[model samples]
Target: MEGVVVRRVIPSDNSCLFNAVGYVMEHNKDKAPELRQVIAAAVASDPTKYNEAFLGKRNEEYCSWIMDPEKWGGAIELSILSEYYGREIAAYDIQTTRCDLYGQEKKYNERVMLIYDGLHYDALAMTPVESAPEEFDQTIFPVDYKRSIGPAEELALNMAKDAHRKRSYTDTSNFTLRCGVCQIGVIGQKEAVEHAQATGHVNFQEYR
Candidate 1:
């Protein structure tokens, strides 16, 4: 059978990263809470490694923040989870059409795939056919599986291009947002973060 890499959409909940990782790792999409706990514990257990300089917040504060179900996970979480799972995670960025491999420096023998479309994350799996059952999915691949990895990267690039053509990604650097609390207009992620820091308004809606 000619296997193909397919992008599996994950729910747009705040924990999409964890859910995507969960789906790719265990074929279960509901492991967000458990994964969040894993990240929190990992952070708490190593303050020197996950310090405020790296976390952008106090280690303890970051741990508590990560454990919140509504909080989103990103690079820091990815690194911690990569160490926890002892496998590399290749996250294909739809905006940049680039693959960032977590745990690559760790020299892991296996890796899983995820697609990041700026605002959300999804899983990538190799299947026998487009309509193959999830149980038949192959999300983990050996690092030395050059043939599989090559095609998987191609598929991810194609998916990224398609998403780009659809303008389906949030341009964090240049998007306009309105704070849901104070209803103030802010431009880009930087401004939004500044507004949030000043007013404690964590809720925002993107606008054209």
Candidate 2:
């Protein structure tokens, strides 16, 4: 009896990365705040390693920014969390159909999967059946299990291709957005950033 690999959708609350990671690690989706703190604390503890140059901001500023619930997490946060958890974190990107392995150099004995569809993150799991619930999901995979791991990777690739075909990703460079604060329409990332800076309005909603 073989299991099916599937992507478990996480909420779009700007904390999808943390939630996806938490779900795969602990079967808990509500650990965003705690995980955010973990990254902040790790950065604060090693100012020399995560310096202003490396972080694109002051260490204290990065720490403060990460603690904000509205802030999104990315590569730096993934790297920090990977070291914190002592496992390889593989993010399968739908746009590129590439799996970016964080902590791969450390040769971690275990690995976890996440689906990254350009703007959002989702957890990847293997279950007994296609429609099995999260409770029956096996999110963690031992690095040595090539036979099983191959299926998971294949599944992720196929999912990514499907998402690509459906145009299910946001091209930040050329997307329409409406300011949630004032309802002003903006085009693309450049206008959005300018609008935010000028109006101090950070909330934005994308539309087709």
Name the top TM-score candidate. 2
Q: Per-residue lDDT for 102 in model 1?
A: 94
lDDT of 1 by residue, 108-129 (tens): 8888999888889999998999
In lDDT terms, how accurate is model 2? 0.88
TM-score (C-alpha) between model 1 and the true structure? 0.91
Which residues of candidate 2, in runs, are more than 4 Å off? Answer: 145-148
- Give lDDT tens digits, candidate 2, residues 54-118: 99899999999999999889999999889999998999887777888899888888889998877
lDDT (Cα, 0-100) at 85 in candidate 2: 94
Off by over 4 Å in 1: 145-150
